[model samples]
Target: MTQQHGETAEVRRDDGELIGMLRQVTDGGWVPCAVFGLPLATPRSAEAARGFLLDHGLGYLADRWEAREGGEWVTVQIVEARPGEVTVSYADYGHPKLFNERRTLQEPSPDDLRRA
Candidate 1:
């Protein structure tokens, strides 16, 4: 499959359609983001997004794996990370409920990295 790009982009779930944005945070790790709903949030409704990244603020960004996803992408959030695995969620903020589903990936070796 063609690799999808966009750090500060939307998270599309199912339907092969756009769901909402997935703003990636670059700091202590590679996957910390604030998910927001479609058309982007108007400062007010963006609480969820901002709140998620609130704690990670400066420190996390400094040590994270440098990366960027630039536009409205898919609805998936990396909630937890381990030495060789990661826990994720369907980040369709459009759903009323921000986190709709959760999943885990064993490992993302170099081969798993998406082509830029």
Candidate 2:
């Protein structure tokens, strides 16, 4: 999946082969965070980051592969493997219907305030 940021695009690869392109936002001198399809609002910690990604229905922890200095690979087992869809929520404050249907903010009359 391609992650669109603004203009520049960074090619992403899976298994050492080009799969898709992700847009770049800022230069970090290494791998751009946008390449992972994560927004800037993502938490900085690894655990929080993983949780946010999972909550947003991106990818899940299928298995973890760790490599040692000797080039040995270790695989960790995954309990769940159900992938879900990603959704983003937003509010349109400038819509004409929304503004028209909203309740008006009016100060109560002196008599009404006295009754309260």
Best model per lDDT: 1
1-116 per-residue lDDT for model 1 (tens digits): 01235545333334543333344444422232322121122232234544433433323312322111243333555566443454555555554443556655564432322212
Report the Cα RMSD per candidate: 16.8, 21.8
Judge candidate 2 at residue 42 and give its lDDT.
27
lDDT of 1: 0.37
Query: How good is model 2 by TM-score?
Result: 0.20
- TM-scores, one per candidate: 0.28, 0.20
- What are the Cα lDDT values of the candidates? 0.37, 0.27
Model 2 C-alpha lDDT per residue in residues 14-110, reported as the tens digit of each score: 3333222232334421222222232324224433433333343322222231211123222222222211211211112333333223221122222
Looking at model 2, which ten-residue stretch has the lowest summed lDDT? 107-116
lDDT, residue 100, candidate 1 = 52
